[model samples]
Target chain A: MSRLALPRWSLIAALSLLTLAAAVGSLLYGAVDLSVARLIAAASGEGDRVASVILFDLRLPRTILALAVGAMLGLAGAALQGYLRNPLAEPSVLGTSNAAALGGVAAIYFGLAELHPIMLPLLATGGALLSLALLFILSGKAESPLTLILAGIAVGTLAIAGTSLALNLSPNPFAAMEIMTWLLGSLENRSFDHVRIALPCIAIGTAMLLWNGRALDALTLGEDAAQALGTDLRRTRLRLLIGTAIGVGGAVAVSGAIGFVGLIVPHLIRPLTDRSPSAILLPSAIGGAALLTLADLGVRIIPTTNELKLGVVTAFLGVPIFLLHLMRERRIW
Target chain B: MVNIVLDHVGVTLGRRAVVHDVSAAFAPGTLTGIVGPNGAGKSTLARAMLALVPANGAVRIDGTDVTAMPRADLARRIAYVPQGQTLHWPLTVERLVGLGRLPHLAPMSRISDTDSAAIERAMERADVLELRDRIATELSGGERARVLFARALAVEAPALIADEPLASLDPGHQIDVMDMLRAEAAGGGLVVAVLHDLTLAARYCDRLLLIDDGRIVADGTPAEVLTADRLRIVYGIDAAVETGGEWPTITLFGRAP
Candidate 1:
């Protein structure tokens, strides 16, 4: 009968439609607007060459990336929260994003990014994996959620310190400016090359995280009971860790640490689901895509001296809602 | 019917041995109670038998080793209800009970008619059918315990193991749960419970296992294992045992000199 507050399929379909609308808005609403007629012609490879170039070369990649990166972050966040059984967990909470940012910054600092086009994402993914390994070592046989979160906080703090040290020891003002701009995080001018690098990892990682839904459901009964119910907690934990690392790793490598989508999107959509950890994943992913694409549009639409950073807009939007959530759930907390 | 055998089972948590080298066999159609004083490792021994803890030697169910069995397969055969678990998520009572069907269903599959019926039966059996719509986190301690018991019953497994299942319940509910366990045993299910109440153990259990310092010090019928001398040695108290009625009743006098 009425098992769920909101039916899962309806919520998914609604969020999917919203994500599509936001994606369309992202494609059309830019500094230069290409009309629908021109856009269709360009997509089929026949109309105004300039409009065609703008659609294919610039907007399409940015649109696709915003959707993919946002989906990855949202999925990763939901997975982490389910795995940790903690509402406070997110993609960056485990230090993977900070580690990725550090990796990207190190590439910039050492001038390796200049050597090749693929250097940044490669190094960033490497950093994420390394941090995950260190996380396991730091929280050996992580039997408790508290232990993992503490280790994550420690690793994230270290990675943040490392990134700041790089900023403090800048070789030149231009290089410093370059690092600073990247750290602010944007979807601007992100080519299909960026998408090409991030997509494979995100695609694989998405499948891994999604596969963990049942295991996450079992864990709601607590670890021992879950195990007694035929859940292999060790396997479940491994999948969430590697899945979050690669998925969020790929995303942060491309978008330069776009925060809040991972942290807040699940909270936003959770009330719409049956509130099972599994039921929240798809809606959160779709909602994350919609939010980021819409936020990207906002950054472009606002009349300011410079285009606003995407992360700044998300932080501004996320904080008040997060605080409100905290207030509402204060008794539970 | 399922038979559970623990062959030289031992459990070491960190560097300390919580359950020592223990071997026991439980038959079908019997309610076997594991009785012990606090910190006597009854819970650890139950976990070891269920293969929840990392244990040495073998836990065999129906001639097959539990360690080698797939988790879902094992879960389908034996239902376990662990004690004193806090609800991590605030799911409704019905949904929480439905999780017992997880071992039977494929991933992402909807609950079939069979599952729904099982869930309903479990709720009715555990006497929580009226609490189906209630949020499990908001329930009283006794109600939550029954709700969890309903979750285990929903499994409909051939064997059931419950640790401290009678804790946090009123006397009437405690009697009800003991009756339910006896019914499970009568229905040809192997039922094992770790109990703290000596009178309940003596009344309901077909066999009583008295454990002390991680070892089974006595294993027999309640009258044999719950004598005044064993009570004085194991619990370190003088207890008056009255067995003239239908069941033995133990009354503690004072600490043993």
Candidate 2:
């Protein structure tokens, strides 16, 4: 009813436009270079069959994957940040993204990648859940936020070790390629099959993550304070665990591994939403889609001898920027 | 009726005994100052009372043994403000204060008008109403201190326990905070806090529990527990007790060279 107070409506509109532009850009620009007019015409059944084939067969799936992957990474990242109450934290730092990478890599190494495509997401999700559980147990002696992060780092290292062990034993040369793919992250050649597998898990996870907003807000004070306020600490933590596992697990499952989108998207958008966890979440979903699609577009245009992985570009872009921000904003840490 | 009792309570954290054999009775509707030096197990004692620690004995809140009470019930009974809390992120003071309503709020239910009123009233009492829209992180030390108290106030518990509530505040805010705490006790809520400023505690607290080496060395009215000789033994600081006006104040004069 009132537009003067917070940036709620403007942010929503900005996010909507950004999401739309990115979605359209995802469908049109690439090596095949179908113009915006052509892609739209094809989708609306006015363009030729060849244009329709390019739009539907290749661009459409990739665009959808971009949106799904972005939303997953962004929401997952936002969850980690909100859960830990640390701006610097994300799925990668907490081990979810890396562990998911290891799970997907193991899936490829065993040559069982296709046999149960579901297995890959499950394994990745398992890795995330297991690490989160270990973090809780091991960090019991430690105090509030620090304990969780320290435990996450330790458990993530363990998951990475397991991933390494899997790769060491695989006889498939494709396993090596898969490792590179997982390391770099990709949305290239993704099909309806890939989208189908990832979207549901990501959707379920995002919903769960969004549901955690109220609890996360409660947690900003302190655990005991949050509990005193009637926040069911154990139950809230459980939901966060499941949601993080599903969303990060699913995104990692399809992309292999991506870096920084989770951290960057949330940090950039959090202030814009007046720091309301729920409001920030949806914007993060939309912003993440835009960022990833733009990155994916950049990877396509570079024309390098060797194909660039989305993970590499994301890390290359994400790390230094995060560090600079961290240096400035780490006044409390 | 809101009195709390600790009977032979002991807490060991990470293989070290932080609090040992703490047995005492806290008077209802009175501000009881828990005074001790650094690492004197003040926080440990508060945690034990909340049943946050696996202690050796019983902590009874309003006559119900904390061990037998549901954690939710216990949450409803006591509101605890821990020490040196660093809440990162730009949380609105109102939102942060509203978190105190968590115990009273049902799961998945919307905040009722009563909850809204409670939060507003709590904010006013804690003097954080103008800070409602401000970020918690951006508030001054004095403002932040009160907002935290507002959060505790929002809990609407019969007993409120704070660990060194005024330790970080400037002298003026320290006095203001101490007055607010005394008001809570006067309002029939049991209030307990660990204090470092002997003068402030002596002037404000109705009773004092002097602790040393994880045990209560002295427990009585401020004048009784805060004698010069006991202050030397408990805090290892030389002091002379003075009587100016009706309040007996502690003046620490270092032994002659």
Candidate 3:
């Protein structure tokens, strides 16, 4: 229906290629340059041992995590926007990221993160579920988007205050520093274990969101007409909230609260879509993967005293575009 | 074609009983107009009958309770157009109309030729064929109303219910919509519309249901329901009703003293 954009399938294909290219770039460009020929040789177990360790142990897991986490954020953002019928709706607006951050902070504050490798992510995911519970209780049976968003804001603010309190009451300077660094978010030195913790949950959450595409399309007509067209609003809301929690929870468990991927990617990809809520989901996911993969790549290339936090880079990149978008859409509101 | 039976249906919204124990039967081949004053529960009654709201009593379609029916099956039998909806996205008019086929679509499936045909026919019936490529959000109020009507028509259901369908239309377009509803009824489909214009309801409807304070005050032909005394009592208006012509017409003088 959108005349200026390419067809949906071709757009998806192009975005997929871009994401793949960014991923390849991510593997190739790092502090110690590893040539492609040597990288391939290392994969086959006959190249330099150092090159093999760098390729297999370091970059591959980080690249895979970038792809998975980016896709999850993008998909969740698009789905939340569709369900809420608000352009501003994203994964963070539902408070999952903040809650996950609070969980990670709690893990560091209590010295439990050192107890086991999986305890941090486990508690972080539990925190995300807790936010979901709080949101449900606050919203009650009201189906209004404003009500849900207000409840999310309430939960998110509370989580932020809790995180701040933990930071203020530091057991030691090193523990406080660890909490701050984790809160900033990163993909550096992440192993395959992190990948395993995130992937299955992201996969399940992605499926749940994609399955509601038709219901989201129906909602373009408003809640009453959507229900008349057989969209079960209550069930759709539950699925979306749970899907976002699981997907974003798994992501932030490993990568901290990577801001702007969810909020900015959908807007970037929207013009390339038919502008229907359903039409934006898959392309936004791929676009998110490309954007984050590219941003993570930029962090490696940019010369700095210390590696920039992924969330900081995303916020810097996101704010200008978001402001421009707000300016353009101000008339609509 | 279908028959809708509302048996002692009542709706309560947030501690306020909006619609009382109202019962009625609407069969195919007739257009029924529901006319009532503001806050008189006409819309709530219609919503309760369609199972769009939680209600105390049973609403059956062709002898099956609507609450027991799957939402998609209920949607297949009845298409609804709600009141004063604002489009959230800037989708094209054609795609907006195609949303009516959602009930017929399987997950991840593209719209088939049959669905496209229904969409085209619905646009033609609502006389919005030329606006198919236009952005729905940019349309004028009248055009948007017609486009939304086209979307409802695209469902091609056995029955149609429209609430305030003529709110923003011009006089000519209002007549056109009324004509379309009449044609739908004449084609052996059940049509129910909530109307505020007494003259249009009187002229186009086969039967009129007059409601006041969540109760059906009058029910019959327009002549039976649009009496001067009933209008004064129900609507709180001093008005004159003349039925000598083709259809009854009401002339308002002032509010009741």
Candidate 4:
């Protein structure tokens, strides 16, 4: 135990430092290129008004949202994987993110989001909760990866079809285009309001997921063994479901269903934590933050005319690696 | 010292009575082996005692009903090693064993010196001390079983129930585990193991429980319970019981007529 603790703590510290570097990089290395001097001056309220506005209003909120949403996805992924006892379990794999996106799109289509800003996140969270509830009901008590992923595909397809049907029937092409861009999941032109909307939900969700660390560890021994060890299985399941829904829904409301960050980040850092499901949470959160921030930064740096969508960047970076992992895991099993 | 008393305990799974009206008293300083054919509810009986499954009747630990007891308190009193193969992650042996101390830990608290000592002692007792740094998933079947046994021992609970602890073990490992359970019982813990190997049960267990169709047909010393008549009646096998050595041994002949 002593032999492993130092390395684990160091790994977390390293990942945290990397996330901080990525966040600072996200602030400094955008199209405007704010130097460290300019950033310091702006932070201290003495920089050019334009530079200050760009730094404070644009980059800071984007950086913060990236961190929070990424951390939420990573944490939710770790928790769900632990609870379900399946490494393949993630928000996107289980259709919660797409379902939440559908909910956000519905909010816009029905004009509820235009009337009140909170309705977007609220509806998105409801969608996530509903999808997760359906997934749980379909998966039942035996949480085989096959059952979970199949249920996820079913829910995801239905939610995507619903979004498309709404798009097809819309009278306004501009609203349809806006929904399409949102569904692609970009961080462009987001303000502090998006950050404010997501922070509380992410905070609550992260806390709920972290609280189940011990229970998750116990669950690695199987449900009956874990229950015998005094873990409250039902409560753990409830907390995981609601917590992942809240976090992923809030993220989807703002960023519109970023793919594969939840699935990829935990697997990336799992070996560092000695493969202990509970131990992977914090590292995965920090790693996810770094990965998403870097991915978002890549979207900015790339020479694409319209700027690559954040979700596209993540999917492009994550899918091949995920497939490789799947291949390796298949051989081992 | 703890006394686990089962009073007419019954378990219904999917509207089927898997275990019905079972009664037994397991006291400290004794190792009880639950022996029966497959699907005879031995595993379910162990689960019911730990409250992992809901039972129709009462399971009392030191005069308090287990259903009414707090889960952590129940965990502190009784440690269970389940029959299912459930190791999914590739955690090191030490970390896996440390999880046994969860019931004793406060939320967010680190494993203290006492917990570490208990974990170390458990690994030593289970004879897996050398494998502490090894990953659990990479170990052989018998080795993993020993690591799991070490995890249950690390709980240090007064009452220990293991379902099929002998499964997948080689001969030497089988003896090692049986001896460890016997030692635990001798040190004043109530150790219950569900076993299919009647010979090993007759040799090591202080008490033998014979269950057929979720009912305890016999419960007594090894010699009393491993009778040829009982073996033929319950197991549907003809067997010769030999009581010449330090322990009674059963030799199977053929199917019961």
Candidate 1: TM-score of chain A is 0.96
Give native contacts recovered, as a fraction, per prediction: 0.73, 0.49, 0.80, 0.75
TM-score result, candidate 4: 0.95
lDDT, candidate 3, B194-252, per-residue tens: 99999999999999999999989999999999999999899899999999988899999
Candidate 3 residues lying further than 4 Å off, grouped into runs, are: A1-3, A329-333
lDDT of 4 by residue, B83-184 (tens): 955798888999999989999999899989999999999999898999999889889888898899999989999989989988888898899889888999
- TM-score (C-alpha, index-matched) for candidate 3: 0.98
Model 4 lDDT per residue over A166-226, tens place? 8998779988997888788877777888899889888988988889999999988987888
* Candidate 4 second chain TM: 0.97
TM-score of chain A of each: 0.96, 0.87, 0.96, 0.90
How would the candidate models be sorted by lDDT, starting from the highest? Answer: 3, 1, 4, 2
lDDT of 1 by residue, A309-331 (tens): 99899888779767876777795
TM-score for each model: 0.96, 0.85, 0.98, 0.95
In model 3, what lDDT does residue A303 have? 93
lDDT of 3 by residue, A40-97 (tens): 8887999898988888899889999999999999999999999899888889898999
lDDT per residue as tens, model 2, A1-333: 111234677887888798888888778888778876887789899998989988888888888888888987887778778878777778766677777777777667776667976676666666666666666688765446676677778878887787777767767767776766666788887777778878888888888888877778767777766665556666776677677777787788777788889988987787676675655777888889888988888898889987788988888878776676767678533
Q: What is the lDDT, from 0 to 100, of the residue B215 in candidate 1?
A: 94
Candidate 2: give the clashing pairs: A184-A311, A229-B102, A229-B103, A230-B102, A230-B103
**What lDDT score goes with residue B43 in model 1?**
96
- Give lDDT: candidate 4, residue B64: 97
Cα lDDT, model 4, residue A301: 87
